[model samples]
Target: MSDRAEAAVRVIEGSLRKRGRLRDSHITLAHGSGGKAMRDLIEDVFVGSFDNPALAALEDQAVVALSELASHGDRLAFTTDTFVVNPLFFPGGDIGTLAVAGTVNDLAVSGAKPLFLSCGIVMEEGLPVEALRRVVASMKRTAEQAGVYIVTGDTKVVERGAADKLFINTAGIGVVPEGISISARNARPGDAVIVSGYLGDHGTAILVARNELALETQIASDCQPLNGLVETMLRACPDLHCLRDATRGGVATVLNEFAQSSGVTIRVREAALPLRQEVKGACEILGLDPLYLANEGKLVAVVPAEAAQRVLAAMRAHPAGEHAAVIGEVTGEQAGVVVLQTVFGGERIIDMLVGEQLPRIC
Candidate 1:
């Protein structure tokens, strides 16, 4: 490993100081050997932190009783994510919340109702036990709030000099109800493009927290699960064309992908996109565009012109979609292009980001 990597490992180990009750000089290979050391580690650390009925069972696979969900014969949607935010925690949430939210949104944007999640954690030899515990607890809480269960999990501890403090991977499963279709390929010309709320809050908040950059206003990450909001919108606008969470490359990349996949053009008005004052200020200072920054809580939707009002109204009624607006419209011409109409009436092409503006942001 390089000097910086070595130093990072040392820093992580330094954080895992155990006092009176603990009796290990440093994490040994035995800790991961699946023997006594491993059992003790699981019982004392992993289980102690994420203890719940499902996890406590310690079964190879959870015996889920999903009669209510299974009886409907809804198509299942599944997604997995790994989170390695450098700061571990950010303004609105920590890695735990991000893991859950990311998974939930993935299923939601696919027109699915999230059901359960399984977490896998890799811990460095010396991460603070309390911090790990807090993360797991937060994950449980967030999953509950999102109406999902953390049904199973696995834990592994690496050598003191081997890894970062924590890395969490989560896999989730959900059911897609019949008659609901949503995807990038569903967008069509004349469809109205809508966003649930303000953009770039998550990315801006993370930048501020990680760099300790001082600004006049506070920005909190918009990390949240959109399953419920999607459900409401589906009820209000059953013919909704498409849905997507503006993550990673944000609204620009998502729109571009839709245009390419569905063979349509998206014309967005710069003045119509909603962004918080604090987020806008931070983006300006950082030389970032809110349109390309990541968001965890917000969603983009495409609906027929006749269904736009009902869809927007349904979104606004939900807490997650209060700032929803019709930001753009799909066009038959200029296929595979995303154009932004500036406040001065000039048009510019918005393309996928060549590289990530912020790395390890989610």
Candidate 2:
């Protein structure tokens, strides 16, 4: 492995060893009472796992030097997201992993290298303390894997029925390298549209985990950090026109946003889209469109046609994007619209949904 890769592995391994055991089976109101109990919980759980000089200080805020930030890029990218997925635990990941990956992906797709994060966690009074420890450990592992740090955080406890078992809000900061100006409006006519991998895995996995449809299938949420994958793609195609994570509204919503922002039409081929067998089956049974489902780890890239092949090749080389494909292209005709050619050879416009199809799946 490369030196950088080896270092990352070590970080994750060290974090795993530092995780603290939570002795309390269940949480109580005192854990959030801003007293000794709260102090012990924070020190033993979050700080123990996410050990680093910045976080070790236990200050009200983290201070990063300007030179340290300037060395990475000329522009800073900042974003925040809240994760409240029902059923705190899922097949492949839990709320903690989702919280970290979601925020990291947001920064990554903006052509940035994610660096720091602040986490705010809310726990219900009666929730299991062990469960909180597990989630915090997961977050620590994910941050190490992503090469970012959780520098500051806050914890709150609410009445048992006033909140869900747990909820997490994360704010992230990253550095956008010089000469990299990726944006939805940068997409132009003839730009090739690429999807990193299969769609709807996350939405389908959450649906099955909830057991709301009485369906049984082995599908795991595609919740993962995409910064490493995005970094590889940028190396191959530095002039990438646009990049957007296929989150809440999935690939379809991302494409529509690109079309509207760039004032160009996006034409996607139905057969070219990639979907896992389980996801396809679930969508069929649920009478839902896979294109509109949510995905946590996937992203859509629009680059010049000349660089599409190189970028796609680079993406496929990464583990996170093994199923990457060139699914469509941008056009000047029918501006501000997205057209999907059906498997039956019919074409139809894809519009943004007036209401959400799946709520709190992310």
Candidate 3:
């Protein structure tokens, strides 16, 4: 871990130890009444856990100095995402970790350094407070690991049955360094396409967690913050063309987007695609395509062919990108299309899904 990330983790651990414990065992309607109950909930759960100067002020909005923001980069990148996974607690992560990592990855894939986040949680009145606490703790740990702060947030409670247990929304801000212009439109012929790690683990893990399929495989969700990995890649290949997190629509969706935006054909080799054994088995049993499965931590980067080796080396050195691979390349033929070359030497068009295959997996 980097020095900044290590320091953030230390701060989070120290704060958790200092704040004894949350007293409420279960959430009630009173906690959302904007009274003493609400105050206690916020102070004990959210504020106490995510201790930071901006959040400590207890203001409606976080105040940040322009000088502080400008020091990191030339432009700001902002993104928001909502988490409503069917099973709040999955095999490897819960809603809270997903919320933090999801939003942070969004900014990171935009070639930005994530700095701050805003969390908005909706709790079911009868939900157990312990569950909420567990989720909050995960968020704290993830934010620390990502070297970002949750500077502001809000909470709301709804009657039982109104909400599935808990729903979390996160908005994040990041700084994009000067001369770093990464976007789908930047993809060009002769550029190398790379995937940070194994795909479909997250989407498959969610399905197994829900017991929708009787197959029992140990596929855990690949939910993680990618800013650190992205930073490493940028340092090695500053002229990267495009970087995108394979989230809701997975790598196939991202490739299609790049193809459309850049008006180039992306040809991927099936033999080069990375996949975990368990995830592959699960997908086969469920009649799912790993290419279309959602991935919370993985990313697809487009970089000049000359820099591909260095960029791939940088990614493999990072913990989050140990399984990175050079899966494809950009081509001028058949613009706005993604072609997957099978292991058997045959090729087929990989188009975007016309309808939702797996909803709420992220």
The lDDT per prediction is 0.84, 0.92, 0.92
Clashing pairs in 2: none
| Window of ten residues with lowest summed lDDT in model 3 | 13-22
lDDT of 2 by residue, 246-326 (tens): 989889999999999999999999999999888888898889999999999999999999999999999999999999999
lDDT of 2: 0.92
Worst 10 residues of 1 by lDDT: 14-23
Candidate 1 vs candidate 3, lDDT winner: 3
Better of 1 and 3 by TM-score: 3
| lDDT tens per residue, model 1, 1-362 | 99999999967754453211234644555666777666555565555555567766768677666777775446888899898877887778899999999999998888888987888888788777667756877787788779888878777888877877888999998888888888789888889999999999888888888775677558889999999999999999888888999999999999999999999989999999998888877877778889999999998999999899999998899999999999999999977999999999999999988876899888
TM-score of 3: 0.93
Model 2 scores a TM of 0.93
Tell me the lDDT of model 1 at 86.
72
TM-score of each: 0.88, 0.93, 0.93
Those runs of model 1 whose alpha carbons end farther than 4 Å from true positions after fitting are: 1-31, 40-53, 65-68, 212-216
RMSD of 1: 8.3
